[model samples]
Target: MALKFVRGQGDGQAESGEGQKADNTHSPDNKSKWLVNYKDRLYRLSYYTGVQLMRFGKRIRRHAVAAVLDAQDWLLEQSAETRERAAYARISLRRTLEQEFFSPVRAFRARVKELRAEYDSAKSQGGDQMESFLAATSQELWAETRKVLGITFNYVAPLGAAALLFVTITTVNSFSFGLKVEYNSKVVGYVRSEADFEVAQAEMKKRIIYEDYIQPEDAVPRFTMAIVNDKDIISTNDLTDRLIESSGNELQEAYGLYIDNQFMGATTDGDSLLENLNARLEEYSTGAKDEKVSFVKDVQVREGLYPLTSIVDLRNIESELDKDESEERIYTVQKGDAPTLIAQKYDMRYSDLKELNPEIETELFVGQEVLISRSVPFLGVQVTKTVTETEDIPYEIEQVTDNSYNEGFTKVSVKGQTGEKEVTSQITYVDGVETERIVLDSRVVKEPVTQKVIVGGNKPLSYIPTSGGTNNGGFIWPVGGNGGYVSCRIWGYSGHTGVDIASQPGTPIYAAAAGQVVTAQYWGGAYGHYVKISHGNGLYTLYAHNSKLYVNPGDYVEQGQLIAAMGRTGRATGNHCHFEIINNGRYLDPLQYVG
Candidate 1:
């Protein structure tokens, strides 16, 4: 047996005696008697166990080492393959052992141990039975181990028969048995393999422990708040009183409701506070309405006048109306009011109000009444005037005489006189002497001199009729006269057609006839302080270059009623009214219509 062991160790050195000699130093002693005795016992035991036993034992040990090494090598091969497939698969052996094998070892341990026990028991049993049992056990072990190793093994013939039976049983068991895992009523992980089963079980256990140890009181709920409206409050009692007055409820119910010092609504307890308050507010709001009064104040005289040709009056009606009307209510001039005052009160255009009382004059009197209506129109104009006068002129006259000779053999002389004239002259004598003479002539031509003269002066003029016109009746010219000069004419350009009326700046432009205002605007585009009135005669009058307008869009206007004060506006060379008379969709010269 010692020789056999030595020979086994020296098998690679058979050709090198020197190598054998060197190995001998590390070898077990052969000369010692006890060593010899132990060797003899070992040899007898080997012989009694059968030559097959000795060979089988050596084979078993060799196979065991080879199996482990092969499993490791297979694992490495699988890792290399996995790496080639996906970069993330290049896991370390330690990680693989923990995740794929050790982690799942608990789930698979029972079967593995059973297989191992069966193998050991079969080895103890003798003959054909042992071979069959070992084969079955090895096959079972391989199946369990293959999951971790990613490899397979083969069995001998007799063993193969038993292995087939084991495989059948194992497959059936695998299909029938499974672990179920649940999380928060939802399934997140499934475990069919031992590795996966073990990991899931561990994770579940850890989560259970954490949940059991934590306290609910340690966590707090989150909250957020916001302020919807903020306003100053002068007094709580005042607010409460207002709420009570406006609300159809008692003081207790009205304690919390007010809108900017006015009573609005009532509030109940928290449940229906908003609902009740809103309802009360709606009722209060409905009660409020706007009331407009046609205000008139007499013109106050300051104890002097050239009949008071000019006067300044602040209407104060607008401010009063504004104050009397509810915030939610709109106040419009119904009748008998000046558009300028109404517009000033509302910060709107006089032209906008002009539609309400078209016959109203630009030169409004304190006692004259006009209408104020609801439709707030946008028509604003600014009036500005400048007056200038000519300086004093002087007059002068002179006289003159002339000398002449005619029809004489010896210097016959003649003289004649001409009518009133002024002249100065000088004559030269052949003796280097000079004579001076003067004459004057003056005569006023009284036969209605027919020389053309521009009729109107440069001073600004207005055409507002002073009498015989009202908001209802069509306007009658306040002053009797022919229409002013045809200073300019209307034409078409840039696909636009309109007329330009050249009058002195600050001319009072009136509504051509009874009409409703359709467009009233100031300072927008080419038309400045412009107004368009629809006369129902298939005619409309356009007035532009106004320093002021006195009507609104929807009000009825009478013919020849003052609508605006003419002045220089967009594209105007000087102060003049750009007037247009449209009849049947065609523009006629204002000169043709006005007269």
Candidate 2:
């Protein structure tokens, strides 16, 4: 039989004429034929023998299976000369394809149109040199166009792209834009969201209240918010709280004070008010003051983040944030207790404490129970302020002495008159507690009148009763706390008529040597609320600046009996009792008899 190569057959195709039907069993290892069919690397149908002619021509100039039929028909109809010329054209085409390259892009339709237009223009001008130049240009353009077309249609390429982006180290990622806050050229904090920035700012304000103590408008720190990309980002976690704490710490110092389970405000100081007390406790525990001064009860000084007021104005702090966290506590008076001391121990004002307990005697008993409260502010900051103010200046009294009068008697030759003055003073206060003062300028508006007195210098020794020199044995100490400090000594200064004994308001006053309540009402003016008593003896004891009086005019109060409470009423700025021991309507220093 003659050897032949043949293409595989499709279903229902007639068998070849002189070939007998092969056996039904086909071998997978057959060199020329196989039973199975599959797709080849060219993505064409492949039999055991060869590949299918489903696609033809350049892979770049993709042609369908149907186009191959036309190509084959054209080839078959070409004469020898045409056929050979076509082959040469194909060779040149392949050379162009191999020489140049292009990315996947739009077809070079512009070049085709350009070439055509140029040809048309040259043809209209009718120049051989121009025509020849255009022909050459056309040939070059043809190749370029084919290259573009090749990439556009002959092959599938992925779209390549590029982009431009801006990044910076001063940015962060968040739902909203970033906010950067700077203070005195230093970056204090950053926030991603607007809400977080607000919170951060609010927290920062705590320092103003707690530390710098400046007005809100005087706050030097500032904030800035802007947009940023992810690449230039940092974190904003707990950012508000962190910034708040950071700023507050920078502004103010902190301390805590405690006393044998009780705290006293006697001699404590702080950068603000609280720290001094707390630090005193710390010092006492460490033996810095007096180690031998042991704790009367609980002997431990607790360390804790004692909350403080914010640096912003107290009014602002109270209004800006919620203070649902405040609590009220009650304290019982222990031995050696006074209203002022109790107020200081609980960190409350003497007047405020007295106001809280209006029913209690100004003087306190050892077992007396009083109500005191501690309110923890939101931010642990105390706002201090420097304020310029004009205040009333008390006129001075100048005394002129004459040696022409009798010994125990004096005459006012010229009456004294008060004057006015203009004073510019700088007052420093923390949370409304005055700490320091400076007088910037002062001018006396009205000159004060000096009192000329004819005094008994050495005239004669007058007969003075010796009976008024000693105590009647019925008096007792009235105010509490270290037995009441004689802040203003008896007639210690000019124009001071009586002794001002300092004590916390609400401290009790006793009936000096069993007296009758001659006057006990709201005595206005500098004495504030006061009480007067007639001892029934030739002498009388007057207790001015009493916050409350338990006795009526006709009521008899025994020695050491609680008759009134100490207070800062009328013209008084603080809690103290102005006491006087008088005989025959003559005022004398109470200390003389009390001592």
Candidate 3:
């Protein structure tokens, strides 16, 4: 590579020559052709530059194609080498496995074949020797066996007899001997062993509650070995019976009262005991002709042997039976449990809770026990009775419509009275709680009265009921014309709020009912001259577009009295009376009242 420096500004002599050339170019003739020359030169430069760029692109494409071909050839060579190396590796691995693992396996297989051949040969020769040896050994063994048999036969009968005698004696002893149970110096019975008597004693103790008998600690029996037959041996229950018999009149025969199959107590006189119990049951029965009473639990008397002290008196048994079934339940206080909360958890009243747990305090600690009161009767008496009672029959309501009053208005016309009826029913009660009721007979003594009520607002008809049929409603027609006719009703036209009564100008309009005048003025907007009358009971009447007003505000006007003169005074095409009925600031159809 060589380096060259081109002078940016030409030397002094060259600069003078370039300046002379520039001046020459700036002349008028040269200046006129300069742009044309510069454009031609620019075109030539662009054509040459494009040609050079094409050549450079052609060179780059050739090099890129050659590089790609070279890379492809290199990859092919590498893949072929990889295949060769993989084949070599595979062959080497096969050789390694054959030498290291399969060689030993094949050697062992050949050795096993040799050993098999040697064993087969040896077995063939040994089979003949074994047969001869077995023949000689069997004969010698038989000879010795016969000698031993002859010796054993000498004592066989004696030894067998001794064994049989020993077994027989051992079995007989097990069967013949038993424990003789003796209690209070008297023999009770014979049991297989003391264990049998112990079981019997345990059972006897269960019946010793309240009995005047020797305690188990004091009644410990003595056991002695004695010869007895198998039939003489007693069972545990039989031993218990013998022991009871040996009590020597300390026990007696009595009737045990069992309620619902559970033994309650024993009584000496069952007949008298039953009579008293029946009386107790009857005491709860209703003294009616068709009344029936019975015990809820099954009661029976079974005859059995019982200790004389175990016999309960009739009065005492009755008192025991009268006690409640359930024991008093106590609940343990838990965390976050208060006295009130504990009461609520058991569904008890606060007062009842306090009564049940008199020692309970307002604050409860965890693990503290609080008593809860709940009762369950041991015996319940179920009573069925047929009874009759007088009952009331409700009256029927009937509604009648009257358009003379406002909608939703109601008034009772007839007062109703409830009638009396006698009803007979079969009622069953258990422990004072009603369980069932069935109606037997019912008869009405008097029929119920039908109540009649007058309701407002219904389909319009020709007649409207009034206190007295003088006019349609409580008010008389305000305008006179035989009966005033309504031309345009309220809501008959758009924006029409009242009824228009067609009449001649200056025709007299009267007050519809007795009322005080609220307004009387020449209000010449929509109503030129009008009179408003306030009738009691939220009712008001407006006479609008009137020619003249006769009543002044605060002045009282009677029914049919002149209040205004009908005329086309304001917003009217012809002479007429615009009448409106208002109730509590609400516009009502005037025709509904007048017509």
Candidate 4:
């Protein structure tokens, strides 16, 4: 065998190996012979192993190829069988659908088509018949309309012609002759109608003032029909002037004072009269710093012709303007109305009222007519002034809710006080009657202190009964069982003397404490069906607006005992209990006693 030299051999072992090598060198022939034999054996073993491995590999490869070919053939066979089965299934499905679904659908579609054809044919025939019927009806209606129109024309034509002829004749006659107006048998002028003559008379009456209904004899006019041309017809104004000229009075152009369009008096000097009127307004406006003064009635001066008899002396004009005129009006007396009160209502003296109403000599009765003079100044002046005065400012309430507090409990933490304010207003007075007042500006003299009120928002879950009785009396809610709440507070404002506990209609009401029933009856006024209980020590409780009362007067009831039912009666707006607590006839706040 071959000697192997290990790598980890010591130097001494290497030296021994060298010696052995030298010895081997000495037996080189024997070593060569052994090595060749070893080589040859090794080569034979290698060649045999390689041949065996090649043979095994070839056999394995051939088997694998055969297996692969078998698998491909099986796969192809399976694929062909699957394709055939799929084609057979597709053909069978098509035949099944054709027999079961498509055939029936086609038959139904054909039936529908036949029905549609029949419906269309019938519809076409109906349309034609309807069109023929409508055409025949339209022709008949047209014929009837023509016949009726022809008959109406035959009857109406003659009457229309007669009406036209009569209207034409009446119009021609109306335009033919005018009225000849003659004043005092002397011809004044010709007017188109008698209305113009009447207008002239009215104008003459207005322009001339008659004493004791005395008028000129010739002032009366006569109207006669006369043939006149268009140029001969005069207007109402022109006829009025002509009649005035022929009145045989000294007619001078003067300024006429018209008060509210009614002629008052005539003045020769218009400027002086207007100056006097302005002086009157300035005199009334003297004391007012910011004042607007004007006549209550529209006063105007116009230039016109007036008879001497109609003109008043200029000196007497001022007296006439200062005179007060009153219209005769009937006054019906009311019950409890005295003669003095009636006189005061009209701003007249009692003596003057008695003189005007002699029948009201003693006392005034209802429905009795009383006469009173309402003075109407001829020249009234209206003076509007801007006035400033101190006024009271109403205080406001500030509400604060506390959830910790029990519901239906209210306490005023700060008392409210009225403040002072200086207010400037524009006040208008017409003939001593206040017509309008408008606030112009306001300044606070003192700041108003807001009233702070704490209201409870928390509602108790249930009522906890108290142990005490009438001596140390305790009150409970009038509306038992969580059915009510304090809708309004006690003594909230003027006239509200109690608290309002809102509940359902017919809800049972309970007595606040043990007490003897004093009054239980329907008030018929504001209290409605009510109950009053008087507890010992001058204590009392009142319940109002009840639907039904369970306890009668003089009955005793315990605390939280049913006494009545809630309702909306008398002046109540809804179902609620108006509860009040009184001590010695003095009204007390219920919230102070009960929650």
Candidate 5:
């Protein structure tokens, strides 16, 4: 390549063209678009008011094309007379003019010639030249324009390409259509815009409350806010409702407590109803001592089936929550359970349970239902019924005078016996409580046997009854140990005049009853140590064969006082006590008085 310079007014030209560079940026196809657009305009205008202007432009373009070609031929003629670089510059300029301007104009003229032939051919065959008073439809006009312009491609391809190009360019700049609200990593709802997401997020925040590190019984529900994340679209209204419902426990599982089979109130725990019921009724049973009955809501509180307490249900619940009365619950009669116990369990009076269940008949069986309520139905009712029970009967005693009997000596001919009598009464109950009892009938169920006694009516004044002293003439054991055996009662092989009691050698003998010591002696011809006491009216108690005598001759002795110790002495062969009970010097069996 060679460079050429042009003289400038600011300084003398010297190698100026060396720094200059030619611009060759355009392609032929890109240049052809301008001619193509201009031709399309002319083709359309030739049928309308610009038809003459379009024809004049074509004639002027022909003359301009001829002038440009002759100028190129003159440049060739001048090139032979110019310097080598100048000659080259002129040739490059001519070629650039041909491609940039002359070629497009020549192609346009040739296209017009071809379209004229085609239009003339179609007119000879009576095709539409569109010269009628009625104008062609837009579809027919576009078809004629394409045909005259000799366009080989779709006319709207540029617009379609521009639209597709715009979409492709904008794809990287896209934002989400809406925001998705997530809970535990699951999509719950959507927000349409940044503003909608903000609003929804705020609404979710309001539903949330803090609950952490709290006790189970005291831990109330605390809802968490829903989080918005980038995701697909959803209905804002419908999902918001479900989210709110999840956050609130207004609808909850609970059991309804029914009284007399009627709805009363609802509680989350059935046991709570029972507890409240028992607490309320505790004072009504007279301290309700030993209440063994239990109460529970009869209705089951299971999911999917149990009553879900809603706001409306809560309305009804709170309506009666403060009321003292509970729904009537039926209690079963367990073993050892009474109507009174049931009443106490339900905080009711015993009469209340009785009145509600008349069939109880004063007896309850296993698995029996006792209606528990404030159901003391009647204002008043009276119940009259007969009751039968046994009573003890007395035995009559008779004493017969016998002059032949010794003083203070008597015997029971026949022993007395107590008997029984059956008595029947009528009981009256008002309001299930006992009010009155009246005897209706009586009869002796067993006969009593009278007792007979032979008394010594001819006894002197000095004689005393064998049964003397206090405690009905009873006496303590004369020895240290309780009675095991009396060796002899009377005149056995040893000719014992009184009873002989076997004992340890040194066992002490006590006085039989309260009396004075008539004698206390360790010396006697046949008897060893001996003590005798004379009770009032000539009654005498004697103890013999003792190792020692404790009472003096005139000392007073009480019942159970030690009088003597036992020993084998004098006529006794072994350690034994000779005890004697006599009234007015007449011996009597000691067993009759002491035992």
Candidate 6:
């Protein structure tokens, strides 16, 4: 079938032909101009289809806008619910765009163009009747248009599906993955990002085995380090080099770096770590080079022994006698006096009295006199003496004559019993017998009278018992008052010991009890002007920081005796007595024992 050119084809141009208008819509060779017609139809269909598609697109856009508005409304509602729900809603929108809109937009646009091309081709091809062809093309175009609409609808369906899916999944995940942070073995802290995770892994590899290098006995070394974030390693050598540069000392030889108990590194150039440590130790040493403590050896002393002399050395004595000897006096003893009593009354040494009265007899009779002089002239005096002797003798003799002839005639013959006695005399020499003796005559008058005697003794004396026993008890308060306010407790800072009590300045401080003053002085250190009194028991009472002390050392003070006046002397901050009671060398709570 020959298709005649009609009015220069639909594109409006001419092709080669005799008395025939040229068809310029396409090339001269008839290559099925359906593309041209299709293009035309596409243009027309696209115009109308675009009109319809634009209407549908507008409808779709409107629907999308409405869905977005709905989604936004839902999001706003979700936001109103709670902070956690609002976050979920935002994540839901991001997921929906990623999965549905971004993935399906390309396919939907391509399908619309395909449907328009098919409709244009059918329109360009002539049909049996114009109406029938128009109807068929219209039907075909409607079908394709419906297909495009279906594809668009299909593409858009997922957006809603994704929105729903994301909302559901995000709701669940919010419960599951809700901002959890945990420290893993690799990480030094909570890892929240990929960079943080990577840093943690790297740090794990650079693990410091601190226990390996650090010996248990090694002194814990100190270091100044520039700590790297998240890493525990220390740059000991670099630090030591810097220190050496700053201090102008050889630190590499003296110091080292340690981390987690491990000796990571040491400095090599300067003084060793040992030297630095030694210097520090010497600073705190009990003995130092400049201040040395040494023992002083005992020295033996030799003494020259000399012989004793009985002769008087009167060289210096002559001068002393000329100066004041004339004023010296000596007195003799009275009758009823002994040397001890005499020496005591005169307040002279007994030995000195004995030396002065060597010639005077210790046994003095009533009229006896002795020399009493200050000079050697008194020693030339002499004493007179007298002696006496006495003797006694006794004798007896007996004789009888016969008177038997007259004895019978008269019983008047008396029994003459004569006891013979003898008397003798002897002459003896005597030297100055000034003492006299009296002799009385001795004679017997009567013979004897005899009487009978009884020998038995009487009864034993009756025993009696007396009744009485004694018991005594007493107590006394050491301090004057019941108790006082606790100013300070048994606490110490630095080397200070004991507590302090606050009392008025110039208050008469009494001895806590009967005690000997161990220490009474103006102590200027921590305890101030302090006094320590030692009671016989282990207890000791300290009265510190006083204004005045009434008694000297070794003075025995009784309980409640005024020993000192309180004052803010020495280290005290105020005018108050600092009283402390120490027992067994340990400070006790004075409040417990004072009252």
| Model 4 local distance difference test score | 0.69
Summarize candidate 6's per-residue lDDT along 50-116 as a digit string, tens digits.
Answer: 4686588688998999999998877676644576776788899988866665544555557557755
Better of 1 and 6 by TM-score: 1
User: Which 10 successive residues of model 4 have the least lDDT summed?
Assistant: 1-10
CA lDDT for candidate 3: 0.67
Provide the lDDT at 356 for model 5.
Answer: 73
- The lDDT, on a scale of 0 to 1, for candidate 6 is 0.41
lDDT (tens digit, per residue) of candidate 3 on 174-273: 6555567677677877765544654555434434456655533224456566668878876664565566666554777776676764457778888877
Order the candidate numbers by TM-score, best to worst.
4, 3, 2, 1, 5, 6
CA lDDT of 2 in candidate 5? 12
TM-score of 5: 0.22
TM-score for each predicted model, relative to the true structure: 0.22, 0.26, 0.31, 0.34, 0.22, 0.20
- Identify the runs in model 6 with alpha carbons over 4 angstroms from their true place: 1-484, 492-496
When 2 and 6 are scored with lDDT, the better candidate is 2
TM-score of 2: 0.26
Estimate the lDDT of model 2.
0.50
Comparing 4 and 5 by lDDT, which wins?
4
Root-mean-square deviation of every model: 42.0, 33.8, 45.3, 55.4, 44.4, 50.2
Candidate 4 C-alpha lDDT tens digits along 1-595:
1112111111111223223332332232556546544644564565578679879979999999999999878757786678798789999999987765566556556655665566566567898765665564566556645655665576579999999998996775455455676776688888755445555555555667642223346544555666687778776545656766776666777777767656687878767787888877876674777888888886766565677766777667888888887765879977656566678888887767756665453234578777555567778878899999999886776666688875444667887788999999999976665668899999999988787767556864233323332222367778965768888897676688899999888889999977567688886456778999866546689999898899965455778889999986655656789999887778777766674
- Cα-based lDDT at residue 363, candidate 5: 36
Off by over 4 Å in 3: 1-251, 307-309, 326-376, 433-435, 440-446, 458-595
User: Clashing pairs in model 4?
Assistant: none
Compute the lDDT of residue 366 as modeled in candidate 4.
73
lDDT of 1: 0.41
Which residue pairs collide in model 5, if any?
258-327, 259-327, 259-328, 260-328, 281-347
